[model samples]
Target: MARFAISDLHGCRQTFLAALDTIGLNKDDELFLLGDYIDRGPDSKGVIDTIWELERDGYRVQCLKGNHEQMCLDGTKDPNWLPIWLKNGGRETMGSFGDHMPDEQHLQWMEALPHYLETPGYILTHAGLNFRRANPMEDQDAMLWIRRWSQEVDRDWLNGRIIVHGHTPRTLSEIKENLAYLNHLPVMNIDAGCCYDLPGRGNLCVFHLDDQRVTFMPNRDR
Candidate 1:
């Protein structure tokens, strides 16, 4: 059994699935999804549906909450957040559903998702932690929304475990460069911007946790 992680689906269902196939995931292998399953590209509802399907099929798929997921949940609860969510590509998400809204099951699933996860060798969160905080792990909001705080990572707090996250989209080259310097910088961003179709973007990334392998699947949801 192996462990794999992918992040920032951003509604690119085909690319997400293709990445999974590229990884050759199996039931015994654990799949950690670093969230942003909705918004931006296309088929947000379908992406969530595929996650549920994988769980039902006995795949060990664990999903963390992303900023987009938080925005989606807040948008449903408050009117003010609705426009912000839509402006940030939530409109595309709504269009993915025939009814232009998420169903109860999907909403509840998103609502119940944990913001962060910790294991022996890795700290998994949608976004990086706020190292300035005394206990970065305790800052749930930072886990969902913080950006550009990687430089502040509290190395002593992390000891030797690497931090794996996806929120701030970076080019494929930048993502690979990060892995090369993993010995010095313990944080890695695997988001290749599945929602972005621009240069150096649009590839969905799969990070093999056990052996530290990276696979890039080109965006196909265009």
Candidate 2:
């Protein structure tokens, strides 16, 4: 059995499907989805529905919560978050829902999603932790929305576990260039801006853990 992870799917259902097809996901293989499943792209509902179908078919899929999802939850609680969410592509997500409204079951699932997941070799999260904090894991806000990190962060902050995260859009070249010795720890960012229609972006990426192989599916729009 193989293990794989993908991030920043947004709502590009076709691109996501193509990535799955490229990866040849089977019952034996496990898939970790690192959130942003909705927003910024077309067919947010389709993305959620496909995930539910995959689970129904007995695929081992682990879904994580993303900042966009946090925004979604916040929008439900406070009227103030709606405008911010809408400006940041929440309108596309709502449009995908059409007249049915956001699914309650999905929202509940999103609410229960863990902020981070630990594995033998890596720490998985929607966004990277605040290395500057004494206990980075305790800073919930940084785990969901942090875009930049300092070079002076504690190198041993994670005790040797590399952080694998999304939420920031960086091309493969950019990721490689930026993987410098940051406080002696390394971070791997896999969000290739799958929802974007611009150059140097808009590719769904999947990383095969055991083999350390990366596969990509170009966005349907491109």
Candidate 3:
């Protein structure tokens, strides 16, 4: 059985599917979706539907919560949060739920997602770990939206495990500078900016843990 991880799908259904196909995933392969599954694209509904379908098919899919998902949850608590969520590509998410409306089941699923996950050799989060906290387990905010914290080098954190993250989109090469060390354990960023253009192309990254390989799938956008 193989294990793989992906991040920041951002409702790019085609790209998401393309990545899965490119990776040649099997029923036994475990897929870790590093959050941001919805928003900023034309097919948020499709993204959710596909994820749900994948789960039903016996795929061991682990999904984390992203900042966008947090905004959505906050919107339910405070009506004022709607504007901010909408401004940040929430329109697509809203459109996806069209007429269906948010339900208890959906809310529960979003609410249940953890801020971070620890596997045997990797730690997964939407953003990165908090450096200020005396203990990494104590900080929730840092897991949802941290850039500077992940960039810093700490031998303790490095020796802990590989940190796989999204949120800050940069090329695989670009991540080299953001990382604290080059020779030691490395941080892997899978965002690749499928929602926005920096490298001017929408792309999805696939990391095959067992094989120690990285694969890329071009977004359907261009």
Candidate 4:
């Protein structure tokens, strides 16, 4: 079975589907969505529903919370959080949920998502983990939202598994050539900024863990 990781969907339902099609996913394949599923696009609801459906159909789908999702959850607890979230394409996310605000079910689902997922070879996170934090659990904020600090920190801080993260969009995928000794790991950034229009069209990154093959589906006219 093939295993894959992707991130920063940003509500592009068509592109998301297209990416899956390009990857030729099978029933046994596992897909890890590195969060930011909703926001910045016209079909946030469709995106969420599609993922839920995929999971129901026996596809091994794992989801993690992104900063956007955190903002959505926080908005429910504090009115002030709404503006910041909305400004960052959160209005679309809210629209996806319809007139109904987040209820217990939604909160429970969001809260249940882990900040980081670890496997023998890779660690998946929305944002890179804080290198300085001795324990990942001790710093949930940085785990879900850190950017510069995570990138600038020495790679030696990463422990064991290769850290695969999305956030801090880059023009191209970054694969570190060297590994630091802390945990003997390298960090990789795969968010190709699919929602933003620049350099190239929207991209959905696909990684084949077993084969070590990485490919991307560029934004195409729908």
Candidate 5:
């Protein structure tokens, strides 16, 4: 069975599904979603529904928590975070639900999502780790919101396993240029800016862990 990872879906359900189809994902194959499943695009509710259905049908899925998901969860607990969340595409997610907000099940699912996952060959997370920290596991904020700090590190910090994460969206060329492979440690970014509808942006990316293959599905909204 193949192992794959995709990230920064941003409510683009059609693109997400089409990318899976392109990868020929089957029941036995594993899919690791690096998060940002909601907001910015047209069908946040549909995206969540599809993922739940996939899991119920026995599809293997590991969905990580993204910064956007944190914003959504925080908005539910604190009134002050509502406006900030809305300003960053949470309004579109709310609109996708029509009259009501996220149900209890959805909230719980988002709340319980783990910050990171580690396997023999790869480290999976929503955002890259804070390499400067003594223990990145303690830095939830960096895991969800980090950008340049993780990308610019000159030395390999993962020992040998590569880091596969999303959060900072880059064009295909930019990602290729920035992808690091030094001392057997690689840092791969696959966000693709799917929410941004501009030329180089707005494309969903899927990376196959076993074969190191990268594939793309253009955004439907674009």
Candidate 6:
């Protein structure tokens, strides 16, 4: 089975679908989505709907939690967090819901998402690891929120397993450069800023692990 990974969809539902199509994703393949699935761009609800549809149709999709999802959960519980979350793309997310609110099932699915996943050959997280800790896995907060943690990657702890992650947006060219050196580099960030309509951004990237391929899909959702 082919193992693939992508990150930071950020509410670009149609773009995400296109990426899956571009890769010719099938039931036999495993798709691991590194977080930030919501907030920013449009169709946050639609994005989640696609995830659910994949599951319903027997696709093997694994998801990690992102900082925005955590903020959304907190904002749902406390009025104080509403402003902070709204300021940070929550406004557009709420707009996606329109007349309805996120049902319990959706919230539970997000809440139950793991912060990271470790396979025999790679470690996947929403954000980079905090190598400052004796065991970087102990820092769950950093998994969801940290940035610039690449400089601190504990090579000894990582051993030979490549660290795969997203949440930090890098340009498509930069991502391709990383893919080219996947054999030498210990970490790869696949987020091409699919939702951002700026220079060097706005393309969703898919990383096929076993095949060592990169699939690019433009943002037509926005």
In candidate 1, which residue pairs clash? none
**In candidate 5, what are the lDDT values of residues 1-222, reduced to their tens digit?**
989999989999888888888888899999999888988998888899999999999999989999999999999999999889999999889988994678888889989999998877888999888877877767888889998775554454566777889998899777656454433447888889988967798888888888786887888764
* Model 2 stretches astray by more than 4 angstroms: 150-153, 176-185
Q: Residue 30's C-alpha lDDT in candidate 6?
A: 91
TM-score of 5: 0.93
Worst 10 residues of 1 by lDDT: 96-105
| Per-candidate count of clashing residue pairs (backbone under 3 Å) | 0, 1, 0, 0, 0, 0
What's model 4's TM-score?
0.86
Deviating ranges (above 4 Å) for candidate 3? 99-101, 157-160, 175-182
Model 6 agreement with the true structure over 1-222: per-residue lDDT tens digits: 889998988889999998888888999999999888888879888899999899999999999999989998998899999889889888888888883446687789889999999876899999888988888889999999888877677777888889999888899889988888876668899889998998999999888888677888989796
Best of the candidates, TM-score = 1
lDDT of 4 by residue, 117-187 (tens): 87668878889877676766578888788886644555444444577788777665243222122244356
lDDT of 4 at 11: 82
The estimated TM-scores of all candidates read: 0.98, 0.91, 0.89, 0.86, 0.93, 0.95
Among the numbered candidates, top lDDT falls to 1
lDDT of 2 by residue, 115-193 (tens): 8887677778888788777788888788789888734456566676677788989886665454544225567778888
True lDDT of residue 220, candidate 2: 76
| Of candidates 5 and 4, the better by lDDT | 5
Q: What is the lDDT of candidate 2?
A: 0.81
Model 1, 181-202: lDDT tens digits are: 9988999999988788789998
